[model samples]
Every structure is written in structure tokens, then in C-alpha cells.
Target: MHPLPQLESYAIRTFEIDCNQQLTIPALVRLMQETAMQQVLELNISVWDLEQYSLAWVLIRKRIEIERLPMLGEKISIHSYPTGADRVFTYRDFRVYDEAGQQIATAATTWLLMNLQTRQMSRIPAELLARFSGYFPPVEMALPYALDSLPPMEQAFTSRNYVVGWYDLDFLKHLNNVHFVKWMLEALPEETLAKQQIRRMDLLFLAEGNLHDRIDAQFQQIDEATYLHQLVRQEDKKVLATGRTIWV
Candidate 1:
């Protein structure tokens, strides 16, 4: 296995950019996810490799800080690597840069290994940790803040309902993580989306949503530019995820 981190280059495509010509948050996350998958595949520790052991990776938390959003047609580079692992969680980080080599964004993510059949969290395997020995010295990026202690959602300032669709499910048969961000933001007012850009976002996934599940996305204003968000399954009233976003 290579000890070096992976670096991939890409051009921001038209579909990846929003109406304002800036790359959307979900699009950036998709790029990061793809880059990480490519790296693991090259190292022979990808999801397919793990599935042989009845293990699968699940993203539990992620935090992103945006310096600037890349415009459509802009060339950018993403550097990704496994940071480290604990008893129950593994870490990865990403650095995004523009063509000029200026850092535009950075993200840190935490993942858990789950037993495919049991649907329970598993401890990090020593052999799996050894595969990333060469990629030591985790990048100095800000970790997801307050993920374990999200702000209370006393009252929802705005809310929306969504019925999980077929396309929303990922390979695990659960709603993809990125859609949670989209749903959370959908609960915000149009004026908030139009006037402000998200400077930072923190998300903590607590449970999974399945196809046809009714989800209530709710947002509570925390301050002038900060908000607390939650996605709850309507039938059970179970909170699937909690998040906070700071807008500028």
C-alpha cells in the first residue's frame, strides 16, 4: 500500500455549479467522496474489499469550511488521506485548492465500520489500520465541531417534509448522507438561501432513513446567521440527524 496521500484534479462541471455559478455544497461533498473512494480502491481497502469480511463503511460525521466556492469550469485539485483511527471510528480529511494553488476549502470526516448483517458498529480492525501506516500525521484541519453536542431545536423557524425516494438510497439501502444536507437546507427560507452563503457546516448522522420514509426537516434559528437543523422520521419521531450551519 502506498503511504502517500492521493491527489486528484478535476474541472468544476456545469451541473455541479448552482444558479450563481458557484459550486454547491453537496457537489463538493460528492467530489470529496469520490476522491476518497479512488484512494481506498488503489490501496485495495475499498468498500468492495471490506464487504468480503461482512464490513461496510458508514460516514458518521463531517464538517466543512469553505474559503470560497469554485466557479463553473474552474480547475481544482483535491488531496485526501486517511488520518487515523480509534476504537470505534476512523478519520479522513480533504484539502481543496483552486488552479492557482490557493486553498479554497477543507473538510474532516469521521466514519464507522458496520457489520453488514448485524447492522451494528464494529471496532476498527488492526489490519485495516496498518494499511494506512504510510499516511500518518493527519492533516491540520478543523474537526467537526459540537457534533456530539448539537444545539437544542426548541422551535422550528421553518420546516419542510420529504418522502424518501428511490434515488435517495445509497449502496447501503439507506438514504445517502449528502441528501441530509440538502433536506436540512430546504427547510430554510428562500431569502436565507438567496442572501447568504454557507461558510461552515457540521453534520452528525445518528440514524438511517429508508425508501418511502416520511422525513420532517426542521430548522431553528440560533442567531443572526447560525441555525440548528434536524431530520426526523415522521412515523417514529426518531431524529435521524442533527446539524448546524453558519452562513455569511
Candidate 2:
């Protein structure tokens, strides 16, 4: 395979920033997602490549840590690579840097191979594992690749309702993961969004949300700087995803 930790640079654009002129979480996710797609495509192991095997990648959980959010007009570089794989999951990591080359953010993500027909998790194919082996350095994140459950709502401090739009669905016909982050943030108090910067976030995607589903996004403050969030489908109250975020 090509050299590890492929790099891609982007100039933060007008549309990618929030009203405060800082890069938004969803935009950051899109940048990282594009960088990842480029890396897998270069390795001939992209979702299209796996489609021939009746499989596709599904992201299960992710954790992001930010030293600072890049501002509008800033140039940032994302360095990403596959970290390793186990029976059930393949791991990936990303480091984001600014024009001055200072690290601003890091993310660790867990992905599973899904059987296209059954929509069930699948074991990593030996050949596929072999393709990634030795190309990446030893894994740096902790093992078991799990996220902690968000504390029970106990009465959400704030809530908002949204109907999934056609544009929110991904190739799987399910809501794209980044929108979950967007909805969660939307449910937060306006004061928090205006005054604080996110220092870290952890998300666990529990279920798929289809188009036009009514979603209730709820947020609860656990402490001064930490908060818990949940997205539930209004029809059956099925939790589509949960998240925890810490702000500075």
C-alpha cells in the first residue's frame, strides 16, 4: 500500500463555519470523511471495492478531541490512516493541524464491515486485513473500541424536533452520521453554543434513522462543562444515537 497517514489540506470556506466564524463539527467531519475516502480509494479498499464482496463499511462510534476549532479562512491539514483491525472492527485515526502545523484536533473512529444483504456485522476478510497490515503503525488508542453510555435523560434540559430530510440520507438510505452530531448540537442551549467551545465529544450510533422520520434531539447538562445528548425517533421512541460532549 501507499505510505501511511495520507495527508489532505483544505481551506475553511464561508459555508463551513458557524456564525462565530469557527469551523463547525459537521464540516470537520466532512473533511475527515473525505480524507478517509481518499486514503481507502488509494489503497483499493474503498466502499466500492468492498461492494464486490457484498460488504460495506459502517461507522459504529467515534471520539473527537479538539485543542481549538479552526477559524474561517484558515487552512488545515488532515492526516489519516487505518490503525488496525480485529475480528469485528477496523480502526482509523486522524490528526488535524493548522497552517502553522500545530495540532488542533484528533479523532479515533471504529468501523465494522456489514453484510449488505443482512445488514449484520461481518468479520474482516483475511485478505482485506492483509492489505492493511504492516502499512500502519501499532494502534495507539485503547482496545475494545467501545463508548460509554450517556447518562439517562432524567428530564432533558432542552429538546428540539426535526424531520429527516432527503439530503440527510447516505448511500445506505439511512441518516448520515454527521447529521446526528448536528442535531445534538442544535438541541444545546444557545448560551452554550455562543460562549463555549467544544473540547471533546463521544458518540455512539445505536440505530439507523430513515428518511422523514421525526427525531427528538434532547440535551442534559451533567456538570458545568459536560453534557449528555440523545436522539430518539418520535414514532417508536427508539434511540437513534447518544452522545456526550465537554466544552471549555
Best model per lDDT? 2
Please state the error at residue 229 of candidate 1 in Å.
Answer: 0.6
* Candidate 1: residue 197 lDDT (0-100): 91
lDDT by residue for model 1 (1-248), tens: 34366799999999898888988898999899889989999877888889888998999888889998999999999998877777988888888999999999998888889998899999878888777756756344434433456777898654799999999998888999889988998788888887799998889999999999999999889888999999999999999998999999
Residue 231's C-alpha lDDT in candidate 2? Answer: 94
Q: Which stretches of candidate 1 lie over 4 Å from their true place?
A: 1-3, 138-148
lDDT of 2 at 114: 91
Local distance difference test, each candidate: 0.86, 0.87
Model 1 residue 182 CA deviation in Å = 1.2
Measured against the true structure, the TM-scores of the candidates, in listed sequence, are 0.93, 0.93
Worst 10 residues of 1 by lDDT: 138-147
Clashing residue pairs in all predictions, respectively, total: 0, 0
User: In candidate 2, where is summed lDDT lowest over 10 consecutive residues?
Assistant: 138-147
User: Candidate 2, TM-score vs. the true structure?
Assistant: 0.93
